[model samples]
Target: MAEDIEPLPVPRRIDFDFPDDIDPNWKADDPEFCAMVNGASLTMPYLEPFLIKTVRETARHIDDPRVQEEAKAFNTQEQFHYRAHRRFNELIKAKGYPELAGLEARMEAAYARLSTRSLRTRMAYTAGFEAMTMGVTRWLINNRVQLFGGSDTRVASFILWHFVEEAEHKCVAFDVYQAAYGGSLGGYFARARGVFHGALDVMFNSMRGYKIILRKAGLWGQLRSRLRLARRLGSFAWTVAPYLLRAALPGHTPRREREPQWVHDWIAQYPHAPEGYIPLLDTHSPTMPVPFPSARAATGAAA
Candidate 1:
């Protein structure tokens, strides 16, 4: 049935209005959790461009048309994601984290180092990162209410929108990897290596960013906050452990994985948010949020 569905990688130009008065932890009430998620967001502007370049280059060597098309679509979607996050990062910087720029520069340099590696190595890293994001996407969707409830609407919508797209183009990199390198034992080893490498990159970068944000906010050395952060990390690992293990299997692919119902329902009702904004999720209930088309949609309807 998935084969019967058409590939549509729509480029959305939505923006968020993060008020200057908002706190650093714009999403959840937990300061530690907020810092952790912010840390991850900080990596996108650098990490995503690296992904786009890697996928685009590898797509060139592949003879398959479908894979090529998917690669372009994947790059387009990531383009939207990174740009949106870049703007949000600016908002975070406005909140007085002057040290944030230094952290981002370090991450940029790290990716620059990675760019020198072989094509196969880069593609392996892309596949591995996508695989991990797929797991994180599912986890976030399943626990949407618990994690985002009562959070700032703009920030919540921004994060959910990005992850939803991540889920949408879930299989592109894996397909590219398989097309270029067969599912041989060597391929499996490359994918596994990527998983570890990408995971460490995210964790290390996120932890560093978190410490910077908390230190600037004057919460870094607070024992209570530190303990809460440790517990949250442990719980997150437990939730996504199954996905990490499954991704390591030779035959495992996102094609066999089921898409989350919330993501399904969300996309179905997409373009629903007003112009210049991301679609809002109902933080209080799992029920589908009401769909209201943007001014662009209304203009089309009038036409």
Candidate 2:
């Protein structure tokens, strides 16, 4: 697949402003879902950079030029994602969750430990995280309306754009991992170990985030919110677990992953924005290309 397909990693720097007026609970009044997303947002700043570091280090071990270029492009995308999410996270923090800072500190410590691992182990971790993210983007795109309906469009657009790019570079890490260790039994076992560790770490971090927010909001022990959170988690697992399992299989490649139609269509459309900007995405119909906003509008207004 590496020789068969060309990677188009166009670096579109989308600036999504989450002004004070925007709802802290932005998912259509769903506090559980809001906390869940906010919790995940905390990881982006540290996690993306960790992933970039892992890929960059692994690229030195890979000989394929295309894979190396894709890794560099993938690093660029992750850079944009973390920077944007860091801004969004400030808004989340301003919403009065003091525990967020503590949670973020713990996240930093965890990644610092990961930074000490071997190159192979680190690259395996990157592959695991990327594969999981690919499945998540698919589920989010397919259920966008249910998840983001009646929410802030600017925030929704921001998240969707990130997910779209996640979809765009879906195969880069897997290909890199394969380039280093494709058919060997050790490779299969390493990939499985990485996926398991990655998945567990994500769940733990997200739960830590959720606890910080939910307890701060006085909703952690509340039965109603607990039920809602459980239901949401169930839905997520139901949609994503199979994909993770598939990735663990021998000879599996992200190229064979089944992306949602709109996601595939999005790459096909290939819409471009001015340098340092991207189009204001229409979340309802992701396939539709809206006109780019004026400079002022992109940075201000309705955010």
Candidate 3:
């Protein structure tokens, strides 16, 4: 069935509107908040190279021109995201969050390990990761007020813009995988394993960053503070755990139906969001300008 399916030669590009109500300089006054923001901001740049590498490597296995086009668009959007986040991270550093350097180093090492896998495995993992990101992005957009807590229009707009694009390309990696690898048992197992490991890395790394923030805020010793932290962690776990569990299902399908109505409303309101401003590629080409390193290189690097 996968063999019969063709990848889309051209993927849709979406334009995002920046929210105007939030102040860009709001993070300047809040040290703790700025630290958290910095942690998130630092993640995108580290992620971009991994995404580009994955797309280029997997492109070779794609028989459909459309799929190839989608891969290129995915890389482009990710690059834009990386640049945007880099700027934001710099702002955080300027505000005195230089401790982000160590976190970035740890994240790079983790990704370096991932880069060693076979192309198929890497792509499979990417699809799973992308699916999870789509869910989180959608959830964040739907609950932007709750997440951001303040009326800083700039911060809100920047984050939402990124989420919109994430939602738009959510299906690209999975589609590519199914098209190229036939969604076999081995493929599913590999994907599931990758998702589990990746989730652990994300959770641990995030906790470490959060602890650094707590330490900087001088709240590390208070029991009440610890309880509040636990509650927040519990809440996030409750929110994301179900989705992660469902991902392990043999026929799991991520549907808009399971998400909150606000998410659906946003999706409906912005039906053309994916194609709003970003230009789509006109044609698909088998030959990628950027040649991915051989599987040997990936594995050898890991070794």
Candidate 4:
């Protein structure tokens, strides 16, 4: 664990009351992108609990109070994130995508098998997955305007809030893994292995979700949709490949990762947000400035 680093993730119970009217295609103009994001969201209800349990189990073997405390905070934030996603997912299912029910069940079963791995493997997986997430959080925030610009308030805010918290605790899983293994050579290989194992597993499941949902939408048969989907997939791979490569290095530590200014602004301004909710990003603004309000119904007007 890095003793020199100050501050850890702050768990907020954001009341993401996604309205029944919230659009399935929240991005409106970009249904392909919407499906991609939806696919990722579908994984959360299943993915998060597994991560929470993994960290909880590993904490039993770790003596570092700071690592254990951060793990607890990470679990708390993950709890909020998955529960919120479950709500949004129900809305998704209701919006003529009941086929997604099968997708979620499959994801649940997949994570169950993953949970049966050794403790070191699970923690390594946790660390590796989080390493990928740190880079992804940066990509999503940096391109917030391009990706989420002019999107539904409920959907956009929910996705944005989820990633922001991801960035907040970027170091927790890695720190917990390091504390347990004491940075051995074998541990280095395990951690590196985890980068691929964890990231690939999640990506495989998410891509499945995308395939199923798009097929249901009848877009899967169209050539144009296929090409655009290919392009989107390529773009994401290109953006995050560097992060994965960096994380695979023997000396890689999340403490040294450089985060963009927006993430910094979000962390500093987040505490002032109203109780029980994270506020919506001002999607309309050019820079998407912060000091956000809550995500509840009364605060329905964009933040």
Cα RMSD of all models vs. native, in order, equals: 4.5, 4.7, 13.3, 3.6
List clashing residue pairs in candidate 1: none
lDDT of 3: 0.59
Better of 2 and 3 by lDDT: 2
lDDT of 1 by residue, 69-130 (tens): 88899899899889988888888888888799999999999999999998888888888888
Pick the TM-score winner: 4
Q: TM-scores across all candidates?
A: 0.89, 0.89, 0.73, 0.93
Q: Which stretches of model 3 miss by more than 4 angstroms?
A: 1-37, 255-303
Per-model lDDT: 0.79, 0.80, 0.59, 0.83
Winning model by lDDT:
4
Query: Per-residue alpha-carbon lDDT of model 4 for 124-174, expressed as tens digits?
Result: 888888988977887787888888888886787778788878888888999
lDDT, residue 65, model 1: 88
Q: What is candidate 4's TM-score against the reference?
A: 0.93
Runs of candidate 2 exceeding 4 Å displacement: 1-3, 270-278, 281-303
Residue-wise lDDT of candidate 2 within 128-230, one digit each (tens)?
A: 8888987788777877877876667787778878888888888988888888876688987998888877866887898899888888889999999999999
